[model samples]
Target: MSPLPEVPAAAGVYPITVRWSDMDAYRHVNNVQYLRLFEEARVYAFKDWFGADRDLIDEGLLVVSQAIDYLVPMEFAYAPARVAIWCSGTGAASFDLGYAVAGPEGDDTVYARGRVTLVAYDLLEQRPRRLGEAEREVLGTVRGEPPALRGDRSAAGSRGHR
Candidate 1:
């Protein structure tokens, strides 16, 4: 096998003890469950970076899109899986979060990779909102490390703010 890529530092990491219910008839994690795994890690990253700003949810970002790549099938395990996540980039009114779900040991056995694009919104006005200086600064404070996994489809790997 090709040597695995480096484990880039993440903005946040979540330990995922795959639930019994996460498995399908084949005993592998259901494909859809991967989204949840990504969500868990991303949310943790948001909380870690934003802290009090977490309340911005009311008039802040919403997931405009989410996409994932499955590399290896995963099974429920007592040893928690490691879901490493970070803010890969950002735009005028949106930010992209990157994720890697891997075996507890590390990213060498990556099970899946994903990106979630969140668009800022005005909850009261019912429309999109431009990012403020504060918001931009917060996003910049997250992960500055370059993406470790090659993003085969999206530009989250290196298209916007690093």
Candidate 2:
């Protein structure tokens, strides 16, 4: 297996616990539920980086693409996981957000890692738009890190910001 990528200590971390319904029939957390954890993390990151009042949906920004890599299965009642979000990179019309889902354990053992690229879009125009200044400023603060730039860009594309 390829070595897991290194994650920075300063990467924003949002604490989340497994919900009872998150487990599958086999008793392990379902693969799909992990994405929900990442979603919660992203919301927190948006509020922290941007303003809490950021309502991307109303602004017509929504997630268009996402990719996740599952490492090891998590138990139903495992300790709270820390989902970390790092600003991967920014294009003229889009930007990428990388995620590391680490157990309550140390950082090296990320249960999963992934990236989602968001685009700024004008719903009325039905086309991608440039990211706003405020949003860019929030992303700029988390740009200078290894995992952020080191991830895949072929996966990057424009979609809505939310």
Candidate 3:
């Protein structure tokens, strides 16, 4: 397999445990479980980025889209895998989070790369909401380029909207 690209410096590094249940019949981590891993990382990351005092989830941050590229099969292991996450893009009401699932720090084997688009929403109104200035400022601290997944197009030329 090709060597994975270097993770962005601004990314938050989170160690996520790989449960045996995450393995599939093929003896590798199930493709679907990658999403779960990403979710686990996000839980840890958001708390760090936005602070534990804020309840962003309760306030309504919704996942609008997600994409993952599996580069190498990840076998089950006792040690937790490291998931690096960072804000890749921001808009008026939504933001993109890029993820890289790899071996823990000092280990370069990246198993997958993924991105998720999340929109601020109003739970009471049941509609999308614009991101507040504080939210934007928090996201900016971790902003960085998206992961270089295979067949990725340049963001400026191809990415259409939030």
Candidate 4:
């Protein structure tokens, strides 16, 4: 199969304040905390797409894969850091997201990169489902580049295989 195209820029950016709870014994942001930050940004961006649906999975979106790259260690700061995320590739049953975390405004340095694949699924049937036209259109607004163009550094040794 051919490779997917990459999104030229982040579709949306979310501000994240570093908290004491996010730091590790090394006095730097914990590795796991990066994933949490990505989730925060992704969830916030998707709220519009999810609409009034309290149960997000009611529409069948489920995270099937994830990858992240840590570029620099970080510490707590008063200013809010920015997490930029965007949709890229879309398939019959899934779509991909790309993300980057940057330092506070002005400084605005990127410190991490991430990607995830979300698949439509049938909870009752316990199986994957295809992306519908409405779902594709909603994702199309921010969709463009695939993360592989940035090196495809997904999470290493994740709990589940892709």
Cα lDDT tens digits, model 4, 1-162, are 111122245367778777888889999889888888888877788886656664355556788877777878877788877887788778899888888777777655667878888888888898998877877787888775654423433433444223
TM-score of each: 0.80, 0.76, 0.90, 0.79
lDDT of 2 by residue, 1-162 (tens): 112247654468777788888988988779899879978887777777777677664566657777777777777545677778878878777887888877664544677877777787889998888887877887888763524322345434544233
lDDT of 2: 0.72
Higher-scoring candidate on TM-score, 1 or 3: 3
List, in order, the clash count of every candidate structure: 0, 3, 0, 7
Off by over 4 Å in 1: 1-7, 106-108, 144-162
| Highest-scoring model, TM-score | 3
Model 4: which residue pairs collide? 5-146, 6-145, 6-146, 7-145, 67-154, 67-155, 68-155
Question: Model 2 misses residue 85 by how many Å?
Answer: 0.5
lDDT of each: 0.73, 0.72, 0.87, 0.72
- In candidate 3, what are the lDDT values of residues 1-162, reduced to their tens digit? 122357778888888999999899999999999999999999999999999999788789899989899989999888888988999999999999999999755667989999999999999999999999999999999999877665466554687433
Ranking by lDDT: 3, 1, 4, 2
Candidate 2 least-lDDT 10 residues: 146-155
Clashes of 2: 3
